[model samples]
Structures are given as structure tokens and as C-alpha cells.
Target: MSAGRAGAQIKSFEAWDYVVFAALFVISSGIGVFFAIKERKKVTSREFLVGGKQMNGGPVALSLTASFMSAVTVLGTPAEIYRFGAPFLLFFIPYTFVIIFTSELFLPVFYRSGITSTYEYLQLRFNKVVRFAATIIYIVQTILYTGVVIYAPALALNQVTGFDLWGSVFATGIVCTFYCTLGGLKAVVWTDAFQMVIMMIGFLTVLIQGTARAGGLRNALDQAKNGSRLEIFDFDVDPLRRHTFWTIAVGGTFTWLGIYGVNQSTIQRCISCKTEKHAKIALYLNLVGLWLILACAVFSGLIMYSYFKNCDPWTAGIISAPDQLMPYFVMEIFASMPGLPGLFVACAFSGTLSTVAASINALATVAFEDFVKSFFPNLSDRWSTWISKGLCVLFGILCTSMAVAASFMGSVVQASLSIHGMCGGPVLGLFTLGIVFPFVNWKGALGGLVTGITLSFWVTIGGFVFPAQAAKTHPLVLSTEQCVQLNMTETAPTTAPSVIVNRPALAETWYSLSYLYYSAVGCLGCLLAGLLISFITGPQKGKDVQPQLIRPVGNLFCFWSKKYKRLCWCGVQHDSETILDNLETDTAWKQGTGLDGLKDGQDHLPGYNPDEKSYTNLASEKVTHF
Candidate 1:
């Protein structure tokens, strides 16, 4: 290693890096602008938010993957394997079942309900207060989550290429914001489709080249097994243990439910389909796409394990941060093969920018329709579009600032998982209760939401406030090296303490637990509390509640009845019957089969009256759920 050779290596790495990143930035921005202009007419409120309910299955499925696989997957998954082991891969298996469940059970329900924002269902099922609370939580959590996703890739790019990290962050955010503000959901979906292809191609290329360098698949597998990075199943039942088979199977399923079934960023894509069948097909296809992407990511990690066996980057100090391992590995590969680095960088930026655009689009829609419209009744459609675009710019700035702050935080994966756990659980719970448990009243739903959220936050932030039998007897150790070693081997050393501290404070594997458990906890909490409150407050005489209040619940119950053979006991036969009964009961029966079955000047049902106007006029407007 002469001085001349060393200098050449450094110079070559820098030259290739700049070329790759520059090419990626141009490609992403170009595609983004093209879609923005193409879909500009669709940028009005409804079209801007949900694509005017006209997206097809292929684009929707692609967008779903693009939305979920952020910079975290590109930078974090490989880094995870570089530090820990392969068990992290098992967390994805349960998601297969989750996709199936969502396609069959959840997507159809949302499509049939005919609502724009999922939060709108909360309003109909419970009250305005519940809807507002859920919406606020979603907006806040999404901004934070999207911020971290955007930041991670920027950090990786900066470390490898010496680009200004904050500058990269600002550039990515502005491009995403501009496109989303201009083209709305259509722009997001089309661009995501293009981006997903690039990401997969980049990942596959790395997997193949790294495997070849490590002496082909057989040799790579042998190296990984020797290095103790191949373990895929753990049967541990301990609650504190991360990435156990049981936890991955059960907990991972719930996490997917929250993400695909509840999260607006995902569900909005599904609902945007032109037909219910299209939505269901898109969702299932997304499952296949997700598995393919995860496989590519895991294979890449294993290949890296084989190639860098004796010289781990985290331990050798070649890379100061864990998340930089993947980018560094790509850079090293590019040192040998020139233009390949550009492809990988393009893929990474594609993932990051697509997610940002989707988040900004969803957030702006929620802000205008759900939050702003209530206060400013005089706001016109054109003004609403401008306002939505303005919010996108504002949020882009806020997210970039958060990225700057996150640069100083702990491991990228840990920070992201922790933030997701804190908010995802409670929100999922509220939505679950509203759809699944018809008896849950507003007061109970609200109380349950608060309780579940508080409990989840307490556990995540403070840890076991009072260590039970497990905590007192086994204090969690916080060593990064030990944690990494423990993950590779199923059996712990007899001499070491049973309670070893987990590195990253909480293992990234537990993130699935934190996210998945929320829906069950929140739903159970709301159901119990709502039931108790309804009992205490005395059941509202069927006459007291609004007709629209019963619409969503009735549809949910009807869906369950047809799918699961459950009988509804709320004195309504079909969804239509429920709406008609409520309209007659409230004297709000103006239109005959109106938006909720009370149509104008005609009451088709025998018992329904025709003069009731108690229900709000907005109920008459046709609501496109997608």
C-alpha cells in the first residue's frame, strides 16, 4: 500500500461518488416534475389526496412498497445484520399473512364505506372529537416518521460521498414537496412505481456482485454460518427477548395491520383503486412485492457478512456509524466497478423521495379537509389546493429540521422504531375499536385511546416503571457488542447475567411488538371503556344519535356478517336498513336513500318517514371513500 496507490484509491472513490449521487438527484427530480405536470389538474382537494379514486392495481401496489420501504430499509436492514445477525429477517414472515388479511378483511370494508380519509369513519362511528383526536395523532406521527426516513438516507449519502448532509436533506425534501404539491396522489403513485423498479434492480445487483466476490453462494453461506450470522428461528418466550419466532409471527402481523390496514399513507393507496376488487388485488400484489424486496435486502446483508468476515466495519472503525455500512460497502464495490455506484445511489434516493412525497400529500389533505375546512367555511377549492401545497412546503421545512436534529441522535434504526412504537399503537387501537366493536361509545373510545397510548408510551420511554418478577430478577443490560453476539446464538452463556442489556436500548426487533400491540390494546381499552361509559351514562335512546353515526358501524358489521357469518343485533338488517332506521328514528329522513340511504323525496323502506332534517346536510353529498 504505497502513498501513490492510497491517494489513487481515495481519488477514485470521490470521483465515482459524486457522479453517482449527482445522476440520482437528477433522475428523481426529473421523474417527479414530469408526474407533477401530468397530474396537475388532479391536484384539487379530493384528487390531490386520493387520486380521484382512479388509480389501478399495479401503480397502487408499487406506491405501497415505495411508501413503506424508506431510507431505513436501504441503510438500516444491512446495518442491522452487520451489527446483529439474520434473525431480524424473520420479522418479515408474519407480514405475508397480514397482507392476506388486509386484502380480504380490511380493504373491502374501507372501499365500501365510501369515505375519503379513514379518520372520517371515526367521526361517523363515534363523534367529531374522536375523529379529530385520531387525525391529529396521525398527522404528528407521520411527520416525525417521514422525517426520520428522509434523514437516514441523507446521512448515508453524506457519509459515503462527503455531500453536505443538511443540503442533501433540503434538496430531497424540496423535490418531493414540489411534486406532491403539484400532482397530488397520482404523481406520488406514478413516481413510486418508477422508483420501486430502480430500488429492486439496485438491490439485486448488489446481492449478485457481493455474492460473487465472496466466492459464490455456497462459500458465502459457509462464511455466514461460520460467523454465526445465519440463524433464522428463535423459540424464546421471554417478553424481553427480541425477534423470537412467536413475537415475529404474532407481533409482526399486528404491525402490518396498523401499517396497511390503518395508516392513511397505505390505505389511501388501496382505496384509490377504481374498484374494490382492484384495491384487493393491489394489496395482495403489494405483499408479493414486499417479500421480494425483503429477500433482496436480507440476501445483501448475508453477502456482506461473508465478504467482510474478519473486518467488521463497526468494529474496525472504517465506518463510524452502523447505518453507513451499506453505503460504504457499495462505495467499496464502486471503487472496483465505476458506474454501479450511481445505480445504487439512485435506488436509495428513489425510496426516500417517494416516501416523502406520499407523506406530504396525505398530511396536506388531512390538514385541509379535516382540520382547516371546519374553521374556514368560505375557503374555495382553488384556495384549498394552494393551502395544501403551502402545508406541503411548510412540512418539508419542518421535516428537514427534524432530520438535522436526528443527525445527532442514536442509531437510525432504533430512533425510527422507537418513534413509530410510541404513536402507531394507540392510533391503530382507536381505529380497530371503531370498526370491530359496534358498542363502543365516544366517551369510552376516547378514554380507552388515552389509556392505551399512555401505557404504551410508559413502557417504551421509561421501560418497566416497576420491574415485575422479570425486571427485578433480570435487569436489562445495555451493551451493544453483547447484544449483537446474543442475537446470533440461541443459547446464552451460562456465566453471563440472564438479563443482558440490549444495544440501541431496545432492539429493532421489538419495534414490531411496540407497533403491533397498540391496536389490540387500544381496541380492547376502547371497547371496555365505551361499554362501561354507555352503561353509566345510560344508553342513548335510539332517537338521540345522528343517522350518519350509525352508517360506518352498520357497514362494518354488515361486512363481518357476510365475511364471517356474524349476525348484527342493532335492529338493522343490511347497511341500508341501519341507515334508514336511524334516519327515521332521528326525523332526519329528507332524501330517499340519501348519501346514507335517505334519498331525496322518497323513503323506499316501509317504516321510514320523509320530513326529518335533523341529520347534517353534508350527509347528502356523495363521499368517495377512496
Candidate 2:
């Protein structure tokens, strides 16, 4: 190791490092060229946006896993575990339910719709205004998320490899944008399949190697247990308890709904499958991959804690931020190993690239389908594809530009969840209301969305702008007084920690709400507001709303029917003949209330041309599995 600028210990790169990096960029770009040329004759917007709706289980599932496990999960998860302990891993408890709920409840609806964008379902169920609101929310949230994902890995790479932060950001952004813009969904999915393998290899390599360096798995576990880092369950009833069983298992399920249930990045992959059965299979497979990746990330944190149990890096001033810990640990464990450091860098970049590609592609699809295509219904397929690709370039540039701002934020994982909870919660609520409450009119949904988003922003942004005094938790303790290797030859100057002052009581209470509760609050607020407004203005008839837009609970229990009576008693009954209404809704399902039938009452919906070419032709042509 040699001292770099500011006397920081920097790991130098070799010829093999450049070779490894070049291979990643080349393979990814090569896949783009392959797809572009292969699908030249039939390059329609339908094909570019959804992979011709003929995707298989393995590749699409792997792509979903890659997109779900972004650089935020890869980089931020280990840091979270290291700081907070094993309780952070409790998110896995809710994930199982999420897989089932999304596959059974959400996936079938989108698959049956045969629409290009997920927001199309909104237009079909309610009105164009609701759809536009959801679209704008998703576009903004995904763009901001792409920037944060790109920044996390780039910042870590800069610390370990002495690479420029902006240079690394641009490198990953431009490579992913180029491939995603040119190759469309085919290129994005295939490259994601490749990158996910690299990501798995990278994490496994670090876990196995770092475990050995820390004297094996048993010793690592013992060290973590002794340090109070292995405690998994916190049964506290306190809402402020960050990782309690109630918060992690219950509240977390609400948070994940916004990601898997309604987010375009995830739904687009599910809809790409040829049949609903294949889509379900993909969801189950994605769950298994998610579990394995999360386990690996958590174990890596334990290994890190064990290795530095007696030599705290932060206390020694070796790493400036908590997020930099894993990268520095990698350099220490694999400094002499020729290709391992390069592999680690490649792994982080892989995760970043997969997420960026998904954002760019999803944003492009939504922009063209939700905005542009509405204005020009008869726009040729060639021009539709062109507009989609052009939007990809535009969003890709915007994503990179926004990523620079993340350097000023704290805790990448928390920052991402804040954005998701604040923005995504309202969108999920809108979808949920339409699906579960058949009587919720467009006016009701729109009112709920606006109010829910308003509350979320007021609390979240207020906390950021006027933060209260820090709330403390008991982190696992460590000692570094005996550590000799981390000691620098020259002494470094230190600054005193800052003091915090309290704010008004209302602001304090607002800031005291856990980030875990943000989504739940937003979601419940929307549902309540929507229902109230629907009752006040006038609820839609059960016959008016499509059955496909309704969830299984609403379908099976017949909440709108007088026969059920129990569940429907929460509010005044809108329909007197419950049994007949339920029968009619079920009949509507049997008769096929397809996308065209969904827009029965609202005929003036902009940009919705039912006469456009159906995806059945493209699906027939590309129906082969790998």
C-alpha cells in the first residue's frame, strides 16, 4: 500500500485490473449490438418496451433479482448490518409474503391487461389524470433512485482504487445507457443475467475469503455474538425502535409493496413473461435469489465486524464514512491477490449497471406510452421506437446528473428508502384503492394521492430541513487501542464533534417517527382519504369497475355484496343487491373485460388507441426459452 493525496492509504491497480474492467464493458456492449441486429426487422415499440412479451423464466427472473438488488443493497446492506446488527436482516420475513402477494394479486392483473406500461392499468381502471399522477411519481422516484445507486458504488470505488468519483459515475452511466438505449429490453435483460452472476461471485468471494481472514465462520459468529451483533429479534412495542419484529416484518411488507407490487421496474419484468404461469414462476425464483443475496450481504457484515473487532477502522480514521468500510476491508483482505480487487470493483459496477439500465428502460417506456403516444395515437411503430430510445438517452443523462447530488446525502440505504416511502407509497396506495375498493372513483383516487403525497413530503422533507436532536442506539462496541497496523506514520489533526439543539415539540414528534413507518403512514392516509372522498362525492357502481382491477380479497369476499355484510359494514352500503353485484362482477371476469372494455365509461382518454397492433404477433414470433 502507498500513500495517496491527503496521506490516505490507497491500493494501486495493475494490468489485470484494467483487463477485468474492459471485459465487463465489452461483454455488456456486445450484448447490446447482438440484440439490436438480431431484432432489426421487428423493432417496434411493443418489442423494445416489453421484450416482445415473450421472455422466459430464468433470464427475466435473474434480471428482476439484479434490478431489485441494486448497488444500494450491495453496498448499503452490509454497512447497515455492521452498524445495526442482525435485526436488519429481518426484512427477509416480509419478503416471502411480498413474493406471494405480488405474484398472485398484482402480476395477473398487469399480465392480463396486455398493456406496455403499468400506468396504463390506471387509465383503464380510473381515468387519465390518475394515470398521469402515478406516471410522474414513478418517473421522478426512479430518476432519483438511479442517481443514488450510481453514486454509492462510484464513491466506494474512488476510495479504494483512487479513481475519480465523477469518472466512475460517468463510466457506469454511459456504458449502461448506451446498451439499454440501443438494445432495449432484450439487451437489458440479457446483460442483467450476466451481471447478476458476477455480483453473486463477488459477494461469495468476499464472504469466503474474509471469513478465513477473520479465522473462519465459527470464530466470526462467536466474535459477533460476543460483541452483541448477533441479536436477531427485537420484540419492542416502541414505534421508534428501528428494527423491531413488528416494524421489520409488518411495516416492511408495506414498504416493499411499492417496489415489487406497483413499481414499473419490477412489474415490467413480470409482464414480459409469455404467460401468467411463467410470470409467477419468475417471482418465486426471484424470491430465492433475493434470499441468498441478502444472506450473503448480512454474513459479509458479520465477517467484517469480526475482522475488525479489535481494530475499529472508523476510530482509527482509516475510513472517512461507514459506507467506505466494505471497500477498505476488501483492499486489506485482497491487496496481494492479483485479480480479486478488480473482481470486487466489477461486482459493484455490475449491480450499479443493472439498476441504471432498468431505470433508463422503464423511464423510456413510461414517457412514450404515458405521455407521447397519447398525443399521437397513429404514430408509426418506427417513430414510437425512436421516441422511446430518445427518452432513454434523456433520462440516462438526467440520472447521471442527479447522481452527483447523492455525494452530499447520508446513509445511502436510508436515503433511498426515504425517497421510496415518500414517493412510492402514494402510488402504491392509488393502485391498492383501485384494486380493493371498487367504489373508489377517479376523483377519490386523485384526492387520496394528492393528500397522501402531501403528508409524506411534509414530514420527510421537514425532518431533513429542520432535524431534531439525534436519537441514539446502542451499537455493538469495539476496541482499537491495541491495533498497530492501522496507525499512520504521521499524526492527523482531529476536530470536536458538533452539538445538537432541540426544535419545537411538533417538529420533534414528526422527526421521531421511524423511517420504517413512513410507507405505512402514507399508504393508510391515502386509503382513508380516498374512501372518505368517494363516500362524499359518490361511489362508482360495482358493475362499472372492472373485476381485473380488483384484488382477490375484494373478489372472494364480495365486500360490495349485502350477502357478506360483515366486512362491508365499515361504511354505508353503496349497492343494495350484494349477491347480484358479486355475480355480475364475476361474470364480467368470465366474459373478459380486457383493456378496451376497461375504458367503457371514459371514452375520451388521451393517447389510448385500442386499434394499435396487439403484442400477440410479437409474442408468437419470439416464444423461445434459453
Candidate 3:
């Protein structure tokens, strides 16, 4: 077999490769054109922002999966499993709980609130300051993460395929921005659904082919087992340990809540469904989609280990970073294939497109509704749609530029994830404090948010500057015994590793908290601090707050049980049927559908007017029990 320079086959994109790659952009852009022309002249802000609240469940669910399952998950999870081992798969455990918690607790509150932006709930629950605080956090976190998502895959693909690095970044950013800005949320959703299929097929091609190359599934598992890469459970209680059972189960669930439960992208998509049941169906379908994509990612890691069992790429100096491993493997595995390489890269870009589009769309919605609409309450609805489109264009440019700039940073994979956890925890806490614990006043919510975010940043930044509190868990052994066919030089030293003396325990230091636990620490801290401040500064009675905003977990059990209902919900009692009806009725008016709203003798909210803001609390005083 002819092994080119560096023991890898010569990789280059051919005609078919370009065709396959360009097809993704063309189809995605075509979807945008379809939505843009279909809604021309009649495009209202509601139609633009939330798909007119008439989207079907299946496509929206796929889009939701694509939104959260970024290229980072496609490229990074395998790298995570390859380097750190299989304990990372424990994330699946927490995901199940996330679906249940989000569907039951968070979804009902936001869906019923009849708000375009999720942060608007903060204003209703507490005050404007809290709402804006969470909104700003989300904006910063999502923008930064989108940059990493765009740049990381481009960087890795460039290293392997000689693909233009900056060119890839600009291409993804511009194409995604163009489609989403023109097409609105419907374009993002439909394009995401289309791109999601490509992502699945591309990754599956790699997994199946790499599995066969690693000597079939049985042999792959056998080799992985022999190499110690199959170790899944680690029960260490140390918080600093990166991938322990407790950390993943507890910390992972918290992190996911920060990502999924109250996220604006997820909310906009869910509520866009035609009915409440359709929305629930979307969430549940996304649960399966996440499981499938993530499973493919993790199992591919094992397949990588099996193939490299005798000749590790990193150990042999064939790849510079762990994230490069999968791409390099792709270039090598499909070197002769006409278009599979492009398909895989397209897979990564699909993830990037989904994320960037979601960010652009969600940011526009939040900025327009939370800030612009609030300031210009008298702004016409026609102008609302136009302004939202303009914001989409603005944010799209800003995020794409950020992606290009992110190329200057070094090793952003973990830092971006950490930053997300640091911010998401507090945002999640702000909402949790509102829905689960009604006594937390605005002052307490703001204080808790400040406290939690400050501590999270302190811990995250400290870990970078400080020394290790404990050693990382041992990695499975790697080897380069069969690199003769490849051009490689061994850089790993042959000497025995140095030993450490008097290492402090993981729990001994605050900064030693694992990145996985960042969300948990921040969330728990927010809850504790918010409650203390609420008590000190006069906590409000549950009866005084709106009954619809509070859905205590304590009352979530036994729907027919009256005692738990009365005791737990703070004298606010409503059956599931009554709650869903209220949500449906209010959602109808709030989302610009007049079917059961103004016509059904429900004057609780004003009629939907295209020339006026959808719904507003022009009343300054507390207006309870509408």
C-alpha cells in the first residue's frame, strides 16, 4: 500500500467533493428563499419570529436537535471519549432527566406565558432588571460559543484536508447568516431538519467504515477492551475529577438544564408548534435525536481507538490535537472515496450552520422583544418584522466576524464549554427561582445572579491560573508500534513519569471544581444566595404571585392529590386540564392566533393587531389573575 508523506494517504477534494459540499449550502439557502418568498408582503413579526406558531412538530423537533447538537458535539465528543475515556457517556443519564424536567416544569411556564423571548418570563416573574441580566448573559455566552463552534471544525478540517481554514469559517458564517436572515425562524428550522439528515449520514459513514477498518464491531470492542478504553463507570466523589459518575449524573443534569430547559432557541422552536401536544412531541423527539447523534459520536471514539491500537496518531505525532484525530482519521479512511470526505466535513458545517442560525435568530428575537419592543411599545407590527430581520442581519454579521476572529485564540474547545456552563447556570437559576421558588423577589434574584456568576467566573479563571489539586484519571495506554508504513516521529519520552508528593484532595480547593460541576455549583449557589436574600429583604407570599407562574415540583406528583396541591403550591391550586386550557387560550392570543382568543369571550388579553405590539403589560401596577 502506498503511504504518502507522514504515513497518511494524500488527501484532496475532487469535483464530486465540491458538489456534495456545495449542495448543503444550496439546499439550505433554497429553503430560506422558499420561506422568504412564501411570506412576502404579508410577513408579520409573529410570522417571522415564531413561524406564526403554526409549525409542525417533526421538523421543529429535528431543528431543535440540530440547534443543541452542534458541530462541537459531532467533533468534540469523540475527541473527549478518545482522550478522557468512556465515563463521559454518563451524560446520557442526565439527559433523560433533562427532557422530563424541561417538558414538565420549564416548557409549561414559558409556553403559557405567551412571550416571544424566554427572558421575558423573568420580567413577569420578577422585574425587568432580572430579565435583561439573563438575556445579556445568554447573548454573550451564545455568541462566544458560536465562534468556537465555527472555528474549531474549520481548523480541524483544514489540518487534515488542506481545506482553507479562514475560507471555511467565512463560508459557514455567511451562508448561515444569509439563509436565516432572509428566511426567518422557519428557514432556520427547515434547513436544520435538512442539515440534520446529512449530519447523521456523514457520521454514520465514518462510524461504519471505521468500524470495519478496525476489524469489525466485535473486534473493535475487543481491541478497545484490551486497550482499557472501555472503562465506563468511575464513582470517585472528588468534584475535580472530570468524568465521575456523580459528577456526570448530578453536574451533567444541571449543565443540561442550563443548556436546554430555559434556552431561547429551544423555547422559540417548541412554542412555534401548532398546539401544546405538538410542542411536547417536539421535545420528546429531540430527546431521541440527541441520543442517536451522541451515541454515534461516542461509539466512533471507540472505533478510533481500535484502529489506532497499535499506532496512536497523537503518540506518533501525526495529529497535533485530540480534536484533529477524527478528521485525520476521516481523510485517511476515505482517501480514495470521491465525496465521503466532503460529506463528513459537510456534517461538521451542518452543525455550525444550525448553531449560528439559531444564535442569530434567537438573539434577534431577544433583542427586539426584550429591548427594542420594550422601549418602542408604540412601534408598528410591520416595522417589528422588518426590524427583527434587520437585527438578524446585524447579529449574523457580528457572529460571523467573531468566528473569523476566534481563529486567533488557542485551544478554545474546553474554555468555550466552560464559559457556557458559567453563564447558563445563573440563567437557569434565575428561571428556577421564579418558577419553583416563588418567594425569591427581584432583589434576591439579581443578587443571586450576581453572586453565582461572579463565583463561577472566579472558579473557572482560577483553574486556568492555578496549580492542580489532584492528578487526572489515568488514560488508556496508547502505542505506535506499527508506524513503519506512515511517516511519523515519536515525541513521547521513554522515561518513567514523574511522581507528585503531597497533592491536595480535589474537594480541598474551590477552583479544583471540575468544569462539569461548574453549572451545579453556580446553580446551587444561586438558589441558596437568592433564598437568603429573599428572606432578609422580605420574601413575597406565594398567593401574592401569579398562580400560573409557579409550578412547584412538590405539587407535580399525583395530579389528583389535593393535599400536596394546596400545601406545595402556596395556596395556588389548578388541575392539569385547567392549566393547559389557560395556556392554550393565552397562547392563542399571545401568538397572534385568534381562533379561541377574542372570539371565545376571553377578553383577558387584547385582540391581535398586526399594527400594534402583540401583547403588553402597559399597566405599571401588579395585574394578577388576568
Candidate 4:
């Protein structure tokens, strides 16, 4: 039933194609085995999680880029351009600002904290309850996300190979989990680095061949322009307009913020570097890699639009889903090219594997550091490493099962955004509240978290229950004039359906908001609710709040600050008071005086204690957050 449109001349992969696809699995698993053997003796939980904080910046950077751009991006982007327009490609506009903002402001806080799990910062900044809430939210979000990642490639492979959907799911899921469990973070990062290369090669091959087959890049662009698929920017201010300038450029920034600014998978890479400076350099390098990868995807979209401008598979009903178009196009064009289709399939799964490996590894880290370590304070390093590996296997199976559930969704791309907004937005809001304003106590943060999460679900789920018809839009011009002649035939274009479907007034308005704004709405909701509740319930005194929780700069409204000097024209003076206070605390932690019951009397934890043989020396010259 999951097969492509019935009897639509589906192309099958040849023997060479299977060889290419099998190589990807072999290479990925081989790398995992290589690291597992090399680090067998030293593969402690710390090593499994952060690569012993000794990873080179280049691979880490490449890993971050690969993780961020998953299979959904590679396939969904072209489908988006081909079906809708180029406006969705504008999501990358916020990359530079995000890199600068995260490197200068967010990275310092996390890197300075020396925490393996991002949720650990929640405990450090707030309390155990808040930390647990964040950990649960993160786990749920990642589980859902991993399922989508798994399903994307499986879905694509099914279209190309006629492979069973569950078989593809199990194959990809089991293979990724094996490597992640065996090799840990180093395997994930190095494999990511290798996969990034394969990904680019795959896309470049498609771009060159597809564009040339479409009569060159210039001709493709002209055809796309003629068909109205080249509109890059929509200046509409309407929130319901899916891909407006404000939606993608402004609202989309928060989406990236949730991933790049605070997500565990990304930050784990940042912290795996030798120093905080190396982390920042890796982040900057990731910015370049991110843009390059997105550019290839976007350009491939234009080429797809041109190649399909005539044939129009969706119009001909050759493919039931827009998501299937990418694979179907690959088969239509590259079936005769022997292994090229398999390479493209490998490229898709490379993105998926890297992302899932990073998530599973991070999920294991959080499980051990935040969940298991708290309950069992005296867990030995050997046992802790095994437990983390077990969790990786457990979560991988759970995610693979969830992929079976995700098959019902309309579009993987949209499902992903909804999940991200529902969870990621509120989490980002909690971190933002903690970092920007030191007065928010655990009560306020918890209250805001609950409120934001509830509202996000109410809107997201409500839209699902009471669907509204999407706004009407003109379909692109099409002709079978240049379509590749095969068993297919030209068909008359169908008439447009009515756009306005009658629905309850509340449901109509609620469903009108674009998915891009989901993160922004959740973030703003948390900030406002947090501040309001803080004021009502009596916020913590400014002096009582730890200075480490507050960002070190941008107190422009505080003219009477005692610790910092306020400069004119939106500038901020550097403050060393927080660093000094933290150093004093660090000294206490080192001396075993206890961190005021930090980690529930686990202050002398394996990774934190300066006296521990395994703890790496992370001390460096302090720099201002400005």
C-alpha cells in the first residue's frame, strides 16, 4: 500500500545501485567499529558523550552542519520549490546572525558551565524540578524528531527500490543505532564528517546532471521564472501567509535558535572542542558549511522545477504525495545512470544517519547525566558507560517504532516543524528567561513552561482536529512539451478546487497562523507568562540570584548597575564580578566543600571533580560575554 502510484512505470534499482547503497552502510559501520576498538579501554561515559573533550574543530563543525541539514531538508526543499515556490528557502537567512549571537552570548554560558547535558544547565540555573521538566520535554521532542528522520529516508528508498517501508526503517534504524552504540560521539562526528562529503557529492551530481538534462542552469532558471517558482521573497506581513519575509527571516530565526542556540545535539559538538575558543571557531565554520549545504539544496530545487515544468508528475497523478516527487524525479531521470540513483539514496540516508546518530548519542548522554546519574550517585565509570550504551539501543528501537506511527502524517517536513515548535520553542524561552533576567525563580520558569507548552499544543492539535482549507494559490504553468517520453502520456490540467472551506470561526482563526510562527509564539508566551508570574509571586532578589545565570552584557536599561558600567549608545561595559564569583564556587567544588548541594550532594562527580583522574582541565582565561 505504501508503494508508488499503481502501475506508473516505477523504475527499479540495478545491481550497481545496490552496491553503492551497501557501501554507505559498510563505511558507516566500519568507522564505528574503528573507533570502538581504538577507544575500547577508554570508552567511559565521558568519552561516549563528549569524545573526552578532545575532538578536532573541523570534524565537529562538519558534524554540526550535517546534523542540522537532515534528509527532510534534502528532499523536502526541492518538493517545496517545485510545488509552492522558493520562499521556503529563505529559512537560511538567519544563519550569520544566529552564529554570531550564539558564539558571543550563548556558547560562553554553556561552555563555561562544563555540563555534558544541556538540561544540566537548567538544574544549575534553576532547580531539580525545572531540570527534569526540560529533560522530559527534550526526550519527547527528540524521539518524535528521530522518527521523522528515520521515516524520510525509508520513504524515499521505498519509492526508488520498492523496498518494504518497515524493512527500510528497521535497516536504517538498526544500522545507525549500532554505530552510535559502538563508537559513541567520536564515531558520530567522524561519520558525520564522512557523510557530509558524500552528501555534497550526491547533490552536486544531481545538480549538474539534472541541470544539463534540463538544458543548462540558465535555461532551468528561465523556465522556473516563467512558471513562477523563482519568487524568493514575499513581503507580506500576514501571519497566515506561509513563507512571507517576516515569517522566514524573522520567525525562522527562533526556529534555528532552538536548534543551534540551545539544542543538545548542536551544543554537544560545540563543547567537544579543546577550548571555548575552539568551540566558537567551530561554530563560525559551521555557518559557512550550513550556507553551502542549503545553497546546493535550494539550487537543486530550481533545477527540479525546470525539469518537471513540463511533465508535472503531481498534476498527472503519477505521485500521490508531493514528498514522493523528489524520488520519483530521480528515478525518471537517473534510472538509466546505473548507480546514480543509489548514490542519491545514500546521500539522503547520510543526512538521516548523521542526524539520528547525533540525537541518539545526545539522548544517551542526557539519559545518563540527567536521569540515571541523579538516582544512582555512585555508579562506576564502566557501568555508566554500559548503561548509556544500553539507553542508545533502547531509544533507537523506540524511535524506529515511532516511525511506524509517523507514516500517517501528510508531510514529514510540516510534522517536524510542528514538533519543534511544540517543544523547542518553550525550551528556548526558558533558557532565554534564565539568561536575560536573573530574577525568574523555578516557580516562574515552571509556570511559564507549562503555559507555553499547553498553548502550543492547544493551537497545534486544535488545527489537526478541526482542519481548515489552505488559502488559494495559482498553480505553476505546465506542459508535456519537453517531458521525457516513456510510458507516460499527456493529460488535461484539472480545475482548481474551492479554497474557502467552511469551519467554526475559532478553528478558522486558530489554524490561520503559519507554522513558522509557532516557535516565536511559544517563546514570547513563556517570556511574558514567566515575568508576570515572577512579579506576582515575588521574584528572587537581584543579589540572591547567581550572577552566572545572567548574560554578562547588554544591561542598557540599568543605569544604576553596581557590578557593571553602562556605556552610551547601546554599548555595555564588561563585568568580571560573575567570573570571580564562579571561580570562588569552583574553588569550593574542588576543595569538596560542596556546591550548596548542587547535583544533590554529587558535587564530587566523576566529570566535575578537579581531583578526579578522568576530569580534564578546562580552566582558561575568562572573557566577557560581550
| TM-scores of the candidates in the order shown | 0.80, 0.87, 0.87, 0.86
Worst 10 residues of 3 by lDDT: 593-602
For candidate 1, write residues 525-621 as lDDT tens digits. Answer: 5456656776676543333333333434444446645644223424323333333223232222221112343333324332334455232333224
Global CA lDDT computed for model 3:
0.74
Model 2 agreement with the true structure over 97-211: per-residue lDDT tens digits: 8898899878767775655578888987899999999899989888888888989889778877788889989987887687676676777788888888988999999998898
Candidate 3 per-residue C-alpha lDDT over 292-340 given as tens digits, one digit per residue, 9 for 90 to 100: 9888988988888777767777776667667777777787778778788
lDDT of 1: 0.65
Q: Output the worst ten-in-a-row residue range by lDDT, candidate 2.
A: 617-626
Candidate 3 similarity to native, TM-score: 0.87
Give the per-residue lDDT digits (tens) of candidate 4, residues 26-124.
Answer: 896687789878888884555767787778889999888888777887777778777777777776687877888788878877776657777877886
Error of 2 at 8 (Å): 8.1
Please give the lDDT score for candidate 4. Answer: 0.74
What number of clashing residue pairs does each candidate have, in the order they appear?
Answer: 18, 3, 3, 0
Q: What is the lDDT of every predicted structure here?
A: 0.65, 0.75, 0.74, 0.74
How high is the lDDT of residue 114 in model 2? 51
Model 1: how far residue 619 lies from native, Å:
6.0
